[model samples]
Target: MSEQGQNRTMVEVHRVPPTPKASRSRMWTDLYSEHVDRAATSLGDAEHCPAITIAQLGSVAMIRLDLAAGTIQRTAEQIGYVAEPTYAFLLQVSGTASFSHYGQDSVLAPGDFTLCNNAVPYVYASDGPADLLMIRAGAGTIREHLPSPEQFCGRHLRADEGLSESAAQLCLGVCEQLASGLPEAVHNRVARNLLDAIATAFAISFDGLITASAVLTGRHARVRLFIEENLRDPDLSPGLIATRLKLSSRYLRMIFASGDETASAYVLRRRLEECARQMADPASAHLTITDIAFGWGFNSAPHFARSFRERFGQAPRVYRREKLGVGMPLRAVGAEAG
Candidate 1:
């Protein structure tokens, strides 16, 4: 597909619709089915409707729900809606709410978070108007990075506490970043980091440490996040990142080795991708190629040109013109001249 076509496809995926009104007289009945499709049940006035916004990244989905006073339930039969077990990490963004799971119930004020396991059954209730951020992921995936996630399930982690607060903030931040729409490669790494953040948050809240495997997984995610945040620093290196994150240099290399590339290789790949994005963007048209290179941490012009071509199959200038709709026809002119 053409670049324009690709962009249109992305817009459709990241679209967040406004509050939808129900015209049907059986709006509440319709909501019952909707909540069922989402693996839940609702009890509220028929007039009350829900405002839901969804932002998806890979297997992780972030759902923002503005709901009226009601109770939502997940029954054993509803588990059939999904093939695999899944977990919903709910962050109560506003108003008062309560959660029940595994024979335990907890209340949450604004800023609190709790987990609801869909592998079994659970319930979430709100006293009045409620705003919630829900991060839903495959149960196996969460357990891969957070062994014993069952303990955290249905337990309220108050946001006022230190680690709990950090967890809430991280969930919000992850949703915001994912909603911005990122390239697929970068999106995968960021999604991993978000999962790690959630696992670590649970670990901290329980006054426990992540297992060895979980540590390695979490460290990789954290390092990826650090690299992305510091792409502008020309001095970004595994050693520098290890120092900043208080990890051993060899360990950092080992973490990235599990992927297709080494640490330095991954960094270079990301830098190249970032530079390409800038080149394709019309907003950066006024900047010189060399300036853009240096801005994304490429110190040497010749090195940047060579790497950019090696990765993208074209020179920076040509790619920019083709992408920004300026010099695409020049290729034919150049052929005629030849």
Candidate 2:
């Protein structure tokens, strides 16, 4: 939010003076958890030197990380606290890093970047020295303009072509403004414009993933219908679907390629979505959260809890209460456990 004509409050964090290297890893983890998203961090095969810069532009945060080889993993099981969802736009300013998110893997070259949804699990890793830029914004506002943001997140936006190149230039411009401490008085407008630009870039670059109505065939419809009917089957999977449909698992994958997630990920997401839906329904209010989860094909309670929390940004019990409120019965599932 390097707003034009307005000064920004630059926030910088560095290593505490006189600390042992053996404790550096823990220190880095603490700093990251405090400043950024909750995650497990390690320098990993490189020196412990790490630097962070945070510039506040109202609700938007511009962050810079200069570090050596390292990895940071954010998991659902550890996402205990409740918070609003966020969208992180990570740019690789220098060096390289590989990322895994939304059931897809992507390698980022310099000038490449990716968008991330904070309500889900993700892994960010660098093999060597790297400089990274991240712009974080509230997910609610961003989601308003783009329906079904899944098609955008976790896909690499290369800097060499199309709308992605335009986004890269805008991001670089923000960086320049921040570094120069320019009071341009355009922070709010810049943030909004940046989000609009990035959303457009992702939509245009990965348009095929969403416009399924144009290319969806009878077979595709059948696959989807089959998934809907068998959602309660814990063993339901791509291979099983392909076997029953007289198709190869490979072809199933190809058909689903028009969407963002793989076939398996799609099934899991659907299950979670359904679980959330039922938890809020008045008729299902009597059912325990676990009962709903198990009825929806979840086999492991712990895994379901973790996945639900990660997907919904809150624990199952918390979600149930939020949805049902005091209307939830004393004997209902959420009353006893989360």
Candidate 3:
């Protein structure tokens, strides 16, 4: 971090390139624990440690993290050390990852970006070594003009598309400028511009679908959150949700109608995505395809297989094999043959 004034300091924290493996891992872990949280673990190989370089720009922070193939998660129980909630907008510079939060999951590639809530539990697992640019800011900065920010959490927004591209570019530029040193007034201006760019990116894409008035969008956000929180319930339905939320079924449907998918479709899609995510995880490998399906609210094996194929464009077992980079199991082959 470089400092201009007393409060305005640009501090950069990174691992010393030549450090031994164990010490490097410990250093990276300690750094993240201090700045980010203690929940961060080295996802690299047994001897390898992921490296992160963070630059703090007053209220907004930028980080360039290089993570090896593995997983990192922040649980709800870890919220105490997190202080106030902030919005972490991650821009995938290279590599692929499955980002999960708010009952939504997305596979992000280079030039793709997403929002993560610091107040909630979230997981980011890399398929391989990955580089990411994360801009952290107050939630209000991005949420002020963006309608239903929850809807976009963990949802991939293309950096090459519309205002999102501009925002990503702006972030990179701001970081570059700050790194080279700038006046305090210029730093503040750049920070404000970065926030505005983020707001523009979100509003241009999402706000166009709703109103500036927060009532309808706020209700929609709550509804989406409820759906995400209850996605595992097999009996989850718009009617059930409406009853629980003390709203009429018709109004619930109307609220979701403002967006793309219907309530039922959205629920099913999320369930399918979640099941797919679990199927991709090695930890869940002990669970059979049937168990995984049933665990995520799919009652009928055939129905689950059908919907899984429809949503993912392949059989669940096939998708699992692709994710694990292995051939089909003998049992799967026998089932297919039978």
Candidate 4:
């Protein structure tokens, strides 16, 4: 896609207000079935219920089904109504739901989880009053990182086994956290990491069912190691770091923010410490102060000296002289003043 096309394809979610009764009636008559079909197709399931109320809170889609002591069953034939690719991360908050897909069938109680993809066809039913959280993201966004999007098209992934439990918990936590009003800066910083965590957790739970290798563990580990190794790189901003790591700069910021630090702050701290170490080293007694400062990636001598004093409670030259010995041979100050 062209950059403009890609930008247009990006998911930009807006907070939806609680559904009023009149609005609910109109939604049910006009949009509900179509909405359900879209959701079902993306998750590879046909969901049947008498009445379901949906609420939008930020990016989360919350649905409450009033089965009212009755039961509803959906068949694969009904699932064929859905046409688009999508993911359905369902969290059962109340009542019970029975799901059958991908040659597996299970009953989900409150607090349980079931994952669905709309790339294929499947079935689902519910009894009594049930509240569910359905997390949906564009198929394009998901498939970009998944290894086998086709295999996941029409399946229900149960979270009762393996890594699904952790993934389910993470999904719930993220939804709840997003629902709770987060500051704009912090929200942007944490959103993608939370999404990646949930996606990875889901992939692990489903084993190879979802085929999302890019969201797995190795990528995160490599990025972290890269950061640690290049701690002294002066140009190590989030965008540059992410480009080197082949990840979105937004995702990089989210990762660092999750660690309770901004990307720039993290790089700055690392560089500062590297300079401090070199300044405190005894072997560099022959080199002028500017050379020592510049060697550790400091671009400005005044800035480096000021930052050094603030961090170590002494000027860079004085700290170096005191720690590495002031009486050492003095190499002439050179033009390389960092």
Model 3 is weakest, by summed lDDT over 10 consecutive residues, at 329-338
Instruction: Report the number of the highest-TM-score candidate.
Output: 3
Give the higher-TM-score candidate: 1 or 2.
2
Candidate 1 is scored at a TM of 0.52
Q: Provide the lDDT at 212 for model 1.
A: 43
250-271, model 3: which lDDT tens digit per residue? 8888887766889889888878
- What is the per-residue lDDT of model 4 for residues 1-338, given as tens digits with 9 covering 90 to 100? 11111212222222212365444333433333454552221111123223544434334344444432322323333445445556665666677776643333567776566555543333455545556666555555455444444344323455565555676576566545444534444543354554465566556655743343445333543554455545546666678778898888777665554356676765566566655544554434567777766665667888877776777787766666666675665552222332
Better of 3 and 4 by TM-score: 3
lDDT of each: 0.66, 0.74, 0.71, 0.51
lDDT of 2 by residue, 1-338 (tens): 22232355465545523356557778877877777878887775565477777776656788888877877777554555448778888889898998866655689988887987776666787889888888887867767655555455677888775687788788878877776674547777777787788778777876765565534443564576567557779999999999999998888988888658888888898788768766865557778888888888898888888888888898888887877786567666553335
lDDT of 4: 0.51
| Most lDDT-accurate candidate | 2
Q: Residue 336, candidate 2: how far off, in angstroms?
A: 38
TM-score for each model: 0.52, 0.62, 0.73, 0.40
- Give the lDDT of residue 197 in candidate 1: 75
RMSD of 2: 13.6
Give the total clashing residue pairs for model 4.
13
Candidate 2 TM-score to native: 0.62
